[model samples]
Target: MRTTPAGGVVLVGVLAWISGVLQLFAGVLMLVAGDHPVTGWLHLLVGLATFPVCLAIFRARVWARIVLSVVFLFEIAAVVFALTDLRFLATPAVTSAVLAVFGLVLLYTPSANASFRQATIDRRNRAATAR
Candidate 1:
């Protein structure tokens, strides 16, 4: 059976994709500017990795929720670190923190929880039927 995606999932997926693209652009720019090659490559790798997670989230995969939760937690921690250092928050950091909080809240909402649970059940049913 086909299931409709929760609004939260869609929102998170879109935001994640946008963030990933921006990260990829920043990585390329950093590389061209000849600064921090390691950081630039790391950013490139992260950007490329986000696509599959976004796709999984869009598909309502259970593992996607876990992955996203971990990612958001890291984003929040990074934001806190930046704040403690009294560093000016860049656009990406600010946006990431905001989106990370919003996404986490959405994911934990009652409707979103139900959607995820239902997706899990559907997947299990499908697997059982296939067997």
Candidate 2:
């Protein structure tokens, strides 16, 4: 399971973790401040999902790339929706949107993609050579 660590991925992972914690905290705050639970629950779910993803990214799991890519797209859509309603102008939402964009960009960069691909190729080659 050992894989070469990509610095960009590591940086992205840290940012993801930070954003997740922020979202989780915001969800709690919203829950306490509100009469409704649905919105808070959604934020909580999104936040909870992010912790595992951050770990996966750090480990350079191939699936991490796919999962993060999808999550990025989802968040972008969410941000757009929020912006349309003027709900995304708050400090935390704006910050999370920016961070998510940065993480997505880094993950999709050619260097990051090549590193992950190389890791996969090397692992297969090693396995085949061993056999």
Candidate 3:
């Protein structure tokens, strides 16, 4: 049976994708500007990784929620530090971090929780049917 995505899941997934796109752009900009190579590569890796995590989250995978929670938490802390500098207010990193935080919140909502549990049950049923 086909499943419809929950509203919270859709919201969080959109935020996650937006954050990933921002990260990808930041990575490119950093690399081209001869900025910190390590940081640039890290951004690229995170950007690339967010895509699959997003897909999993859309599917209501429990592990994806955990992974993204950690990522968003780190992003929030990073944004907090960056907020100390007024000049950094307009950066994409700040925007992405905000979006991540928003996504993190939605990820744990009641609707999202129900959706996740249902997905788990669906997966189990599918597996049983296949076997």
Number of the top candidate by TM-score? 3
Best by lDDT: 3
Expressed as tens digits, the lDDT of each residue in 1-131 for candidate 2 is 56775888888899888877766765565566644456556557777888898888887778987887776565555444334433433355456678889988899777788778877888798899899
Question: In candidate 2, which residue ranges exceed 4 Å CA deviation?
Answer: 79-89, 129-131
* Candidate 3 residue spans exceeding 4 A from truth: 77-90
| Reference-based TM-score of each model | 0.76, 0.80, 0.82
Residue 77, model 1: lDDT of: 59
Model 2 TM-score (2 dp): 0.80
Give the per-residue lDDT digits (tens) of candidate 3, residues 83-124: 443234328777888798789889888988889888889989
Count of clashing residue pairs in every prediction: 0, 0, 0
- Give the alpha carbon lDDT tens digit for every residue of 13-129 in model 1: 887777666556545654665335655565466667777898898878879888878776765554453343323423554566687778888878887888888888898899999
Q: What is the lDDT of residue 104 in candidate 1?
A: 83
lDDT order of candidates, top first:
3, 2, 1
